[model samples]
Target: MKKLIIASVIALFILTGCNKDKDILNTLNDYNISQQDKGYHFGDKLNIPQDVLDYAEAISISFGDKETSSLSIDPKFFSLGENDVTFNIKTKSGEVLQQDATINVFAKAKARPIAYEIANQYPHDTNSFTEGFELHGDTVLESVGLDGKSKILKYTLGSRTPILEVPQPSNIFSEGITLLNDKVYQLTYKAKKGFIYDSNFKLIKEFKYPDVIAEGWGMTNDGKNLIVSDGSKNIYFLNPENPSQIVRTIAVASNTEAYDQINELEYHNGSIYANVWQKPIVLQINPANGEVTGILDFSNIAKQNTTNEDDVLNGIAFKGDNMLITGKNWSKIYEVILK
Candidate 1:
């Protein structure tokens, strides 16, 4: 009887040992929730297993060499001001992990030494509340604002003389305009109508917009689709064929708490350039996702004609490879060289 008992005990011990080995192997194999080599975007959320979460007391995030263990935000946008940020993560286990990132925040317009020269300035009518402008070859296309007074004009570069002008439907306020192929597309403020004009500035086709948003402010194109801006901080990418469908939307970054009312837009190289409504500043932004990479403070232009008080920055046009910018009621169109 003793010998039989001994054999049974020995078998039970071996079975328990095997089961423990299997559990350890399973833990080793289940690595789906393990630490990622890089951190994700601001909007990305990561889920950790309960066991991993319990093991982690806190996480340390580092940008470059500076370590920030506890960071907080009202509505977290993952930005630490104007600088591009890359980070790494540290855990309770003393293991460090790297994050592939660039921090994006509302960048304040700092007073950088003006780098570009005022190549030239052109003139527009004093009554035209110009909102957007673009250049194709030597021809300049413009959108003038205000209800019952808005229109799209095609002008000769340098001369500022209008070659063709197409007025918006009687009572609708016109806003931004852009050119794709041979057609000039124009947006209206609240009438929900967008007009397409031929190269000759003749009315070709009209499209209607749904009341998805309150106001139409600015617009540009990326050679593929139309990009529009509402007066708020948000910018929307839309399908050219279907205006209602949104491809993507991004909240613009402003240095101040005030929302930068984006008024005009121009796509140059791979970046999107925008004019702040009623302000004398332009931003060079990344369009892949909405990241404000650089800033061009044309406050000098605002200061130049401080006596007039009518010079508000409003227009941006790219001529060939050069950029031509203008202001409302200002007599000069500026040729700017982006450094």
Candidate 2:
């Protein structure tokens, strides 16, 4: 019995000695370089010169990294301030890096609207990263992001309860979603594919579309043509019959020369309603000239929902006489009736 105890102790000591700490921390390179600013907007192309990448590993930092070398892009927090973002970029060996390059974020400055007075607010499921939302009477159709977990949820207005959910295709990252003539049209992120679903949520058809639109962020229809946004400063008008042909393209107008990430879109009456990805404002755009006529500031909406994290505000639904707005990680869906 004593010999057996001694052997067990030896084995335990050897195992503990061999158990070393794992060194494989997630490197900045492990993440797809293309996805660095997926949730935010930047220039049409990075200005990173070959000389810049020659020596240092190219990394992005958000304003949250102010204390450490890490970087973050919390839209609700840093995006509210000037064009500065805070984040961190640590190396494979725990080394931190920085460029001190200043980024200019362009968020509209407007008065915060009262949560109750601005529009109707509905509690949403936090699990849903709402990308697109549309309304059929009191019924709301929503597009949730992140491939495996993404889905189309049908909910009742005012009540904010999802009554139906349709899973997306395997390996497909669902982005924008809209219904026209009883058929649902959905866009995939960077997949260059569009899916068509029937009333029963069955896959009817899958088609290829433009890849130049910068990840197919949002989609909507104007009864005659399909309008889409790509997290850029422009909106695309395409022929629903033939999406390959660009019918028209409209650049979202802002007071400044900066570009805003136009994520979700809805066509109400004759104007285009777009949700600027990380901002608290919604622009009322003129379809004819692509001019922003009115801006609805809902800063108070975020203040009321203090429990939510810094999320991407991307969902917009327009029903008959009512409008609905939701965010990527928001806990509620708001039924907004603009006064």
Q: Estimate, for each residue in 115-226, the C-alpha lDDT of model 1 and write its tens digit.
A: 5666666666766677778888888888888767878888787676678877776798888888877777888888777877777777877877656646777889999888
Steric overlap count per candidate = 5, 19
| Model 1 steric clash pairs | 39-99, 85-103, 121-333, 122-332, 122-333
As a whole number from 0 to 100, the lDDT of residue 283 in candidate 1 is 76
* Highest TM-score model number: 1
**What's model 1's TM-score?**
0.66
Give lDDT per model, in order: 0.67, 0.66
Q: For residues 106-149, could you state the per-residue lDDT of candidate 2 as single tens digits?
A: 33432233222445667788788787788887777888888688
The runs of at least 3 residues in candidate 2 whose Cα sits more than 4 Å from the true structure, single-residue gaps closed, are 1-116, 159-161, 306-310
RMSD of each: 13.1, 14.7
